[model samples]
Target: MTLRACGLIIFRKLHEVSAAAVGDNIEYLLLQTSYGTHHWTPPKGHVDPGEDDLQTALRETQEEAGLDASQFTILEGFKKELNYTVKGKPKTVIYWLAKMKDNSAEIRLSSEHQAFRWLALNEACKLAGYKDMQTTFREAQQFLCSQA
Candidate 1:
């Protein structure tokens, strides 16, 4: 059985700069897990019983990253899903695009993560460590660029 989950691919437009400079100005959010391999990921977790996929994404974002839905402009018409296996168990993760309304919102982490970062795409991909997640980041970047 697959471990199902969902999350957001959140970015800040860097109000101090322009979109042409987004390659340098954009920052992707990555959280470092406190458990297992201490893998880095976007804010996400296992789906709770009876929760809808989008609801699970929002709830996990709030619980894991201390950012509420009002703090972000959840982009419409963009979604990505990843399927993979962990420890021989299949897992599926859904992601959506969002732009932080407060570009300077301070992230407060829960016990699930040890650290967080606002990284550029390349650095984010390198730190993300897993191929699927790397592709997710790329797709998110493409989505945001299209929105620009």
Candidate 2:
């Protein structure tokens, strides 16, 4: 059986930045896991039985990053699914792009993650350290820029 997970690629747009420079002003939220390789990624977790994908994404985002549904707006038409293998098991992760309503909102981390950072696309890609994840960040940046 494939391991399924869901999460949100949460980001914040800096105020006062012009639309032409929107990409530079956007920042993505990444969390450093406390376990395993201590790798950095968006907040995600295995889906609980009986939970739908979006529900799991919302629940995990709240549980892992302390940002509830009310704190961010989910951007429609930007969901991304990634397929990869972990420990010889097939895994699939679904991610939706969300924009933070309040850029200054505090991020309270759960024990699962040791640290968190809001980084630009390049820095986020570096910390993420996965080709697929880096591609996702680039796609997201382009999507946001197109909307701007």
Candidate 3:
């Protein structure tokens, strides 16, 4: 059976500087895992047996990043699913875009992650490192821009 996980592509809007810099005003959140290769990723984890994907995403986001549902708004129209192989097993991960309600909300990290950063799209993509993850961040940027 394939491994399934879910997460939120959490982002925040910076204070307006200029209309032309809309894209530059958004930043994404990434967490550096403490295990394995210590790669950075959005808050995510394996789904529990009885939990739905979105529930898992919310729960994991709270557990991993300490941002609860009240702290962010889930963007209704955007979601991404990625399929890949990990340790010879097929894995599927789903992500929904969320916008932080307050840019200054404190993040309390769980032991699963060692560090966290809120970064611009290019910086987030570079820190994420994987091609597919980079593509996901780019797509999220497009979605947010289109909505703007």
Candidate 4:
């Protein structure tokens, strides 16, 4: 069976900028897991039995990043699904784009993560490790840029 997970690509605009320039102001959130390869990724976890994909995304974001649904505005048009193998099992991760409603909100990490960073597109992609994850960040950046 394929393992399924959901998450949000949470981003924040650092300062006022014109629509054409907004891309530079945006920063994406990434977390470094405390276990295994210690790879960095967005807040995500396995989907609960009865929870819908979006619900799981929201819950996992809260549990892993300490950011509740109310703290970010979900972008209506952006979502991505990545497929890969983990421990010899196929895993699928779904990610939705969200803009931070309040950039000042503190990021509180759970025990599952050792560190978190809000980074610009280039830095984020560099720390993301895997090619699939790097592509996801690129897609998210494109989506945000298109909206500007």
TM-score of each: 0.94, 0.98, 0.97, 0.97
* Residue lDDT tens for model 3, 16-113: 65656779999999999999999999999999999999999999999999999999999989999999999999999999999999998999999999
Model 1 residue pairs with clashes: none
In angstroms, how far off is 128's CA in candidate 1?
Answer: 0.2
Model 2 score (lDDT): 0.96
Candidate order, TM-score descending: 2, 4, 3, 1
TM-score of 3: 0.97
Q: Is candidate 2 or candidate 3 better by TM-score?
A: 2
Candidate 4 lDDT tens digits, 21-84: 8779999999999999899999999999999999999999999999999999999988999999
> Which residue pairs in model 4 clash with each other?
none
Clashing residue pairs in candidate 2 are none
RMSD of each: 1.3, 0.7, 1.0, 0.7
Candidate 3 local Cα displacement, residue 108, angstroms: 0.6
Give the count of colliding residue pairs in each prediction.
Answer: 0, 0, 0, 0
**Whole-model lDDT, model 1:** 0.88
